[model samples]
Target: MSLRVLVVDDHPLYRDGLVTAIAAMPEIEVIGDAADGAAAVRAAKDLAPDVVVMDLHMPELNGIEATRQIVAERPATAVLVLTMLDGDDSVFAAMRAGARGYLLKGADRAEIRRALEAVAHGEVVFSSGIASRVLSFFAAGSAKSALSPFPSLTEREREILDLVARGLTNAAIAQRLVLSSKTVRNHVSNVFTKLQVAGRAEAVAQARDAGLGAP
Candidate 1:
């Protein structure tokens, strides 16, 4: 069977270019494209593609949350993160969220094709530079209880923090969660205090450092 694929990105030109390039691969089928993370999730559900080519910094849900949802709903569908971010936080967040492959935007056509094919076959793929980071992270043993990312956060606080990390403002989170604006504000405050961060920017930085998700 041809590899069914979905291309997701916020930029129209970039998304179009990606779809064209991927479609040129005779073994792959471009099932659809989405402009943002929420749309990507919805499309993935509706299309049931074999792979989702994802971009991280979208407006609504962001790629990490979308990937988490997709993998949860359809474990057989692989997520390949194609983003400009090479930082540890971005890299780790996507992997932790269940991405099967990670490639920098600068990757060549051959690399992109190979990564997609490998991921669709249940193999993990990463750009050469990113592979080293993954190895270094594991070799350092960064998986201990003492190294817990959000140590003092409550479940609710973590929920709020995740939304905030995804670029949702307090008002947006309130609307999405169907909570009062004041309630969201209070949760945000508590998250800051517990995380030892003074403000939103710091909170996002801390969350991203914990690989909570940044985009």
Candidate 2:
């Protein structure tokens, strides 16, 4: 069966061009299109497409939050991020928000089609440049935390901190560790307190610097 897709972007020309290009693919079907994240979310609920080709910056809502909501509401649907932004913060935020694939705007139609196909099949995908960045980030973090780090934190707290640095949400961490959400939250709080950080971002920065979140 053809993969059903929803194309979303703020730019009229780019969206139309992408829709045209994707419609030409043999195994993909363009079911709908939306001009903003809010409409994208509504369309996702209404159309239930197999994959969403999402752009990061949009009016009414942003792609990251839309991806999070869509994934939460429709676990069967996948989000493929296509954006101009390639900064570490943007890439990691999309991953944390549950995007299944990421590609820069410069990616050609063939690459985009491959990404769409990959995500539709429940596989994670990224452009070569983005993949390199992700690998380098993990490698550096691995090297830094090769030995025991975060001496002040208890073993559990340290474990939680590692997951946090890996960009997992509290619920994801809880699921991975087979702990209650409340217990995960409490451990994360302790990790923050011991690390002298006020929030997850700060804690992640510190933990990654100490090599805690290696794959």
**Which ten-residue region of model 2 has the weakest summed lDDT?**
142-151
Instruction: Write one digit per residue (lDDT tens) for candidate 2, span 1-215.
Output: 99999999999999999999999999899999999989999999999999999998787777877898899889999999999987655676677778999999999988998999999999999999989977875688843332346545677888899999999999999999999999999999888776555688878865775567998
- What is candidate 2's TM-score against the reference? 0.67
Model 2 accuracy (lDDT, Cα): 0.86
- The clash numbers for all candidates, in the given order, read 0, 1
Residues 14-66 of candidate 1 have per-residue lDDT tens digits of 99999999999978899999999999999999999999999987877778888
Whole-model Cα lDDT of every candidate shown, in order: 0.86, 0.86
lDDT of 2 at 33: 99
Q: For candidate 1, what is the lDDT?
A: 0.86
Could you tell me which residue pairs clash in candidate 2? 145-211
Candidate 1 ranges beyond 4 A from true positions:
141-215
